[model samples]
Target: MGDTTIAPPPTAQRRAGVWQAVLLLAGSCMPVLGSVLITPILPQLSEHFGDTPGAEVLVPMIVAIPALMIALFAPFAGQIVDRLGRKTLLVVAMFAYAIVGTAPAWLEALPAILLSRVLVGVCEAAIMTVCTTLIVDYFHEERRRNRYLGLQTVVTTLAATAFIAIGGALGVGGWHTPFWVYAVSILIGALMVISLWEPTAAEAGEPEARDRPAKVRIPWARIGVPLLVTLFGGFTFYVIVLEVSYLVVGTGVAADDTATIGGVAAIASLATAIGGLSFAKLSKLGHGVLLPLAFGLQAVGMLVIWIVPGLPGIGVGAVIASFGSGVLLPSLLTWVVAAAHFADRGRVTGWWTSAFFLGQFLTPILVAVLAAGLGALPAAVGVVGIVALLVGAAVGFALRKASAAVAA
Candidate 1:
């Protein structure tokens, strides 16, 4: 008779122990930091490039280049990740980020800055993609993994919040102090090599098959819903990232006052951090309700600020929007992803990633264009709400289709 033996699965979680989790989380924060650190310094850079339209556009390019490249290269990062494992990629990418991330400030000319941004994006692709893969290797239960995703979002928000104050202050000294934060990646890079463990397939207990719908592609319905959710979330984020200062300025607040402007941006991001941490309570509501609520609240918040126009008004709007995003992002993502088969998850996600990232890249350009004729940043924020409403409709329709398809 053929041998008949079935090993029992381990009860322990698949994720790394706490210390390992901390180090990996820190590694994941590098890309977020590298991106946020540059925000306060963009105005300074615009001045450095001299007064010209091409160079002004270069400022946005420097920021957008990394985001765009990361979107494009994410798949390649996935393909290689299987061979190198997560730690190897994290280590290499972190070190590369530390070195190449700051090269732009050291050089003169806009082209150089754009080049540095592209390289930084490449490193970012590796770091982000690998860190996510590692999380799956470490966590086993669906509920725990969803919670971890919330934690990851919270961590990224905290990094952005902490770095904004630091980077803003550093920019006060000169545009380059903010860039120093990029060096933190080197330590994380090294830690990945020394501290992170490589558990065998059996030890890790990854299962015979994993469910993540993002493989080569997935049901258009699945990809479409999440893609809309992310796209709307990103468009909301763009209001803060590219235009908060401009909004403050256009609204007649102290636009020229760098300290106050930075402080306000920090406040907006703080709302995001709070929202991220507080999202746990709402997870049980599932994606269907949360996504639209998030988008609607954020859109309404934007509308309020658009009509009222002040710091207090802006702050209230930001918190509401942030809370909605905090609830919506993880809930929708977890719901769909929990249903995904691992083989197709990456590819299915490739489309979502591509759409979400494209939104991040396009937001500034589109807003800036709208601002050119619309007369101020506030108009741009309001105009974009139309798109957000469409995303909400998509999310609702997607949930219906996914449920029906699965049932059949």
Candidate 2:
């Protein structure tokens, strides 16, 4: 009989273990900090620049600008990441994020502040792309990668909560106070230099693969459909985060109370964090089981917010929706990453990141369109909820067929 043996797949050696995880997770928080850190004070920032032309539109740009830039620049960042390596770009991006992110503190001109925010977004694109790519890099196993993805969401959500609270408190001083929070990136970047070392497939015994030319054909069909789905996923996920403060004010719940708005946002974030924590265990159910639940919950939550009135109702809706959003993120991320080739991880992830932030950038505009036709923001939210329900049902139906096919 012919001798037969199965060789195990190569595994990357742990470079710095827990410290590496800690630093990357910490770095991950920086990308989101851009919006959450300043959201509570947006009204103030708008007013401060009100006397200057276009304050109405431009003030809000501070929140969306970074997201837009991330959408625009992330693909390029991914190219750099795949070719140049993860650590160097990440470290530079982190340092750049700190400097550009803090520019609003001293800048007096409205246009100048907007410029800084745009620059901050560029850094965020690189930071988010590289950090996510590294998470996949550092962990080879599917379950373990899923776990870290969950952890990454958890840490970012919690940090958003903390930063929102801090921003609210600091807004008592002035809108500029919260901009100081970006300085934390300096420390994170420093820790990265100290603790983070690059890992390669060669180190895992795939020298031939590593030595292959960088110019390889992308498996577009594999990653493309998911990227497209995640674009909508991104749209749905960011609705509450970007619009809840406005919703609270519009509903007559928290009139000019940044602290209360911040508190509500934080609670919603907590719910998302809770959902994220469940991904590892729940993931075994697979997309067929999970997507419906995630979208279904979100639709119900949005419907609740629409039909019910008052802060308590909104709070309940927010928490429920946030949970769905949390689950949705890691689910989509894990799906896309798993489908991608190891060599294409960075660029594929960059496209994925771009899709996500692009959704974020489009959210307010889409909501505005709905609001215009629907007659009110809450009504628009309800209509959107119905749309989500339809999407969920459709996905559930398709998944059932797929599952049946597999069983058959």
Candidate 3:
């Protein structure tokens, strides 16, 4: 180990914080991987339950359902973390996530599986905000925080790749293969419960270090930009998730090749991971230039893939867009946290999370309707492309405003 040195409060010495970063990042990745691991298996889900016509809908419902619940509850997650403390909330969410994720694979009844998914959703809302607050504890200063957040995004992307590969392998084995991805939740959840420490208010950057239940007020004026941006990015993401499986399975790709879907997605997410990690090294334009630039690349990529529909073309487009999203995430998140009032970070972040999931929830349903009516591939890809363009323009506006304000 390198020489360890003591530092004053609010100083984040990079070398010593490595393990802390890993633990927190790993803890944070559990749900993201959990959600997507099942994506490639949706066709299989539809076939299995297609006895009734609407049973096919359950596939998206299972994935998006959790997001729906999170959308509703995320506004309060920060408050709960503030009231209960970070470690306690993290432990509970992790445990609940483990059981809920695992039970779906092991249980006999479909209802049980659905119920388990809902439970996992409940747990995920708590996990997301708490982990975010924990990051504030681990890193100090804007540069350090953005880099760390980039690292965290990369971790999730890498996990997404691994789980996608695993989901594919299992899906190829039969429909049951994807469900086995639940094992990851158990292991990760255990790690969180056993190893992580709950940071107090001082650690999380809230005012009080002691246990006093406090109501966190929303800082709409302060966090308006970041919160809104988060919601927009989420909308773009949901639109893709809405149409991906249908584009493949409905358009002559074999339903059994969950591996193919996973492979393609991983390819894109890998680009995303790289883009985000690369942005971390830069001191300037990581937010001002990089976010909107990435967003623009994403828009172009989406349009290209939509016009020419094939795995090769579509995958390339997604890769471009994915990297853009990757670059934006860390910068935007850091911006939001920095902009919020110290007293109300929790509440502000809670609303931010809610907006993020709300985008995830609403866009997919709208895309689903379009896919059913207008044909899956054309509607999903076209709509996603348009959404990406609109969001890119909006991000450009935000960047200009942020820059002008900073200069003024």
Candidate 4:
């Protein structure tokens, strides 16, 4: 009924190891990495496989299938992290990711490549869940944890943008070349083995605490609202992510030029990353304030792009919209992490990840239906923006009530 966050003092515990944080940051990049890595080359792959049966559907599936897998498998990965421990699962999953992610490099068959992509997704689920769980484990104080959450998002956005650029450049060499980027995880995993310890309550302060699993009752009622909001947040966050290039091309400003479109996308992601960089400072304002601001920026930004005249106008909109997205993730994540019990963090985080990615995977379909009725892609995006503003207002009011009750 009231705020349940445990905001420990800044000196609550010693800082987590630098290498440990590094490994987690690197691993955190894995989920979004696959989503955007192959996007730049989707058209090229589609054309190359034009002769193959169901190439149209299957080729595009290469870009989206991993997200589908993550949405389906993250909860399972969370269960494994809770029972088995985070270190082993994460290390093994990262190694497995490399092999599966690179499978398309030498494989000629579309079905085989698609299968490999699915496997990569499975590994990514574990990788994403473990990395995030460990982060919560490493940082006990709310401020520090929120800072890292912000940094984690910055890494994710910047990494995704870089991967898209790399994938585009490598697409010139061949679509297969981008798959090699998956191999980078193997290197990260090796370092993870050296640096990451299996975090336990004992280490943080409880001397008697063991790494053994405990059957703790989850606070589902507390988590339900945040998770529901996250589902919608995920959809809104990705609308620009998946649609920006399409929107740019649709404007007929870029003239179907992939390079120019990619440039615009990279700028947008950079703006998002810039916004993330500010989160540590802005976090002091609390989610009740931040949530409405984030949604409001996104709403207005989307509307700007919908009616604006040219590439510059769209680029400005993308930046504004992206900045909101950049802030939104950490805000939601910090809220969920604070509300959840430490013992149940893994499962809660897993459910949170699943809800977010599920929304992401469904974005295109939702936008498509909206576009059909709205009569234009930009109009559909505008409608989504309006919905986001309403959602933001509702979340802001609820958060205000929750905060006020805590104050009372």
- The segments of candidate 2 whose C-alpha lies over 4 angstroms from its true place after superposition are 1-12, 202-208, 211-213, 257-263, 396-408
Q: For residues 119-229, what per-residue lDDT tens digits would candidate 2 score against the true structure?
A: 999999999998898887776566777888988889998988888778878999998888988999999999898787677865423456666776766678667777877
User: Arrange candidates by TM-score, highest first: which order?
Assistant: 4, 2, 1, 3
Clash count (model 1, backbone only): 25
TM-score: the better of candidates 1 and 2: 2
lDDT per residue, candidate 1, 138-195, as tens digits? Answer: 6545556666767777788778778776887889988766776788787777877887
Q: Which ranking of candidates, highest lDDT first?
A: 4, 2, 3, 1
Best by lDDT: 4
| Model 4 per-residue lDDT at 183 | 94
Worst 10 residues of 4 by lDDT: 203-212
Off by over 4 Å in 4: 1-15, 204-213
lDDT of 1: 0.67
* lDDT assessment of candidate 4: 0.86
The residue-by-residue lDDT of candidate 4 on 1-408, one tens digit each, is 999999976433345866777789999999888888888788889988999999989998998999889989998988887777888999999999999999999999999999999998899889988898888888766777777889998999999878877887888988788889899999999999887878766543344445535877667889888999999999999999888887888878556686788788888998889778888899999889998998898998899988886777688889999999999888888888655655677788888898889899999999999999989988899899999999999999999999899999
Strongest candidate by TM-score: 4
- Candidate 1, RMSD to the unseen true structure: 3.9
Could you give candidate 3's per-residue lDDT for residues 1-408 as a string of tens digits?
987997767644233266667777887787676577886677777888778556766666877778877777767787776566677877777767766777766565566677878877778788777677677765655677777788877887788767766776678776665765556656666766766675545555544434544565666776776777788777765454445555556546787686787566667778878877977675376466666676676677777667766666667777777777677667667767655544455566667767777877887566667667866555566666676667767767877887799999
Query: How big is the positional error of residue 70 in model 4, measured in Å on the Cα after superposition?
Result: 0.7
TM-score of model 1 vs. true structure? 0.84
